[model samples]
Target: MASGQWRALAEQFQLICPSGGAPGVGSPGALPGLASCGHWVNVAGLQGWVQALLDQGIPSFRCPRCPESPWLWQELCKLGLFTDEARARLEAQILVQEGATGSYRQCPRCQRLVQRLEPGPLRTPCLPCSQQARRLYCFCWGCGRDWPDTSPHADPRCPLQAALHDAPKIQAPPSSLHGCPSLRACPRCYALLSHTLQGYPSVICPECHCVFCYRCLGLSGGHRLPCQIADRQLVCGREAVTLLPMGAQ
Candidate 1:
């Protein structure tokens, strides 16, 4: 990659952190040849790169090769050079590279071994523990703490607990599962009309009120926008459903 392209990608990924000074660091607006060194960065193997920089006395971003020791592994992570385990395998897509966490879970009971398999709620059976205890209960990786009698179950600390059950709730009007509590579709422009019913000849739509005909329920010049019912004479019980819902007489 050319130096400019490397800088561009670094900027895109926010990997380039500008510092005031280092022993041989590049100045702002003046980059060294490191950016375009054409070296492929293995986000997962940044430790190797950090080691190489330290051995070679290169000051790309920070003085990695300084006399004292610095943990460039953490710095590389802070620079966004490493793809997260969840997004590691993301394809060539510009946004997020797809990836998955290796299918494994820790045996909280033993605390010395790892379970190698896709973990599930009350599904991962610790063979040694089950055999030793002579019980059929399995372990759940949810909380990493709670164990169940018959099966695995999600615990309060489980990371997947929120994704499994957390659902967004939209609070609507007291009696209606509909649009805004204070506004309704405009009778003319199809704009939201205030529920308070403004203007004369029925509620005049705030937008293009001239076209509003609440009584006839028509549009501008009675063009009758398709948003509402056309040529309607009576509202039937629907209007009363919204208006006279057994509240104000």
Candidate 2:
């Protein structure tokens, strides 16, 4: 019989099974061992409608094993219907049932031995396999970024990552000097330099070469010239000491 004729026979048998329970057109039903088969078709049919809306045109689909029209199956699979295993099993069952010609037999798809009075178009490809076929990824440690690569499951370590891992680390410039009793500064620029200048153990202004008690200099805080100084000689608080002229003292 044609695939459509086969589906009608199966549907009639399911309705008459008493335990199989009656189902509406496109509705799902539970068979003894293949309880999910009916539900699968129902959902698959619904998904096909959604796909038709997405594709904007109904496309022809065919099952690998059965005579039933694969219109719904084709649309669902094209739109990512059931999972790989589910699709495969559903298709397999339909083929086996129809091919048996009413004799009882185990559905290779459902993997269950049962009596079949009819068969339908049942055959689908693996969705997971299809998805995996299109997958890809990569990691770049040097740039610290991960991205899609042409190869899926490629080597985790790349050339850039290796180089970055092997590169030597560098030290930062020192913020303060060690073993110096007090912090001093440059006499001309007032840049903080040595802690002791001209052998005096107190904060010294980097400019003007004046010395002040650590307290007046705000010892805990970085050394600073008095806020209101003007003249070079007496203008100050602590002054940063610089080498003096021969007679300047």
Candidate 3:
């Protein structure tokens, strides 16, 4: 949550990297350190776990044994668990997943990530591109198209409003998320995420680690139980319904 807390947590565990079977060493995986959750983990094992989570589109890095205690980015970096390049890539994915894609878009010319400095107009300028070209380079932040030399106040061709109103729909069947918008902004951190139907209707934001119900978009208390608002109205124009267990009908 905070830098100080992460630093304190990082101090609680000793991470040992493999030294190629040095003297008095047992095995590469034998260097186990007790994590903050009191579970033993090796550097290699933890790395594998983090990779698996990333592969699954789940960005939250928590103790394998305890999902409640999250491993902050700073803590992971301080522990040498991730390289600089890896950390940058992971943070980029987290930003996109956290619903920052709406605000942060790639420059149309150079394709470098850019965002509005003060949010004046939809025609946002890319400083890196401008510096490289020795001239102003702006783009339509709404549609990701090159900004025309016409009036900056109007772009009738931009389809951002239509795209936003017609967001993708979830196709997973038998789940509460079915028929709902595939993409959702986390209620806490506003991180955008698409449910893969690999788990329940509740999800944990990879950015803020906030658990929320994907159906009614309410805070789920760690998803310990079924969503209480499962039967409420949804944005997809269909009443939300929870599928009971196969034998519970």
Candidate 3 per-residue lDDT over residues 12-129, each given as its tens digit: 4322223322323534435554455554545544554555555556555565334466654444544435665775676576555533333456667866556332344667677656
Model 1 Cα lDDT, one tens digit per residue, 1-249: 244643454444333334423323433433222222222222333434433433333323332222122322223333334344422221112111111112333456753222232234434566546666898535554334536475434343343322221111213434222222232344423454433333233355667764443323444342322232222121121131122111111
Residue pairs in clash, model 3: 98-191, 98-192, 99-191, 99-192
lDDT values, one for every candidate: 0.34, 0.33, 0.52
At residue 108, candidate 2 shows an lDDT of 26
TM-score of each: 0.22, 0.17, 0.34
Summed over model 3, clashes come to: 4
Evaluated against the true structure, the overall lDDT of model 1 is 0.34
Task: Please report the candidate that would top TM-score against the real structure.
Answer: 3
Candidate 2 residues 1-249, lDDT tens each? 355744454454332233333444333443222122332233334333333322432122333124342434334444433565755555454433322222222332332223222232112122233355564222222222333443432333333222322222222223121222232333343444334223333445656555543212322333433222111121122232333322111
Candidate with top lDDT is 3
Look at candidate 1 and tell me the lDDT of residue 223.
Answer: 35
lDDT of 3 at 61: 58
Count of backbone clashes, every candidate in sequence: 7, 14, 4
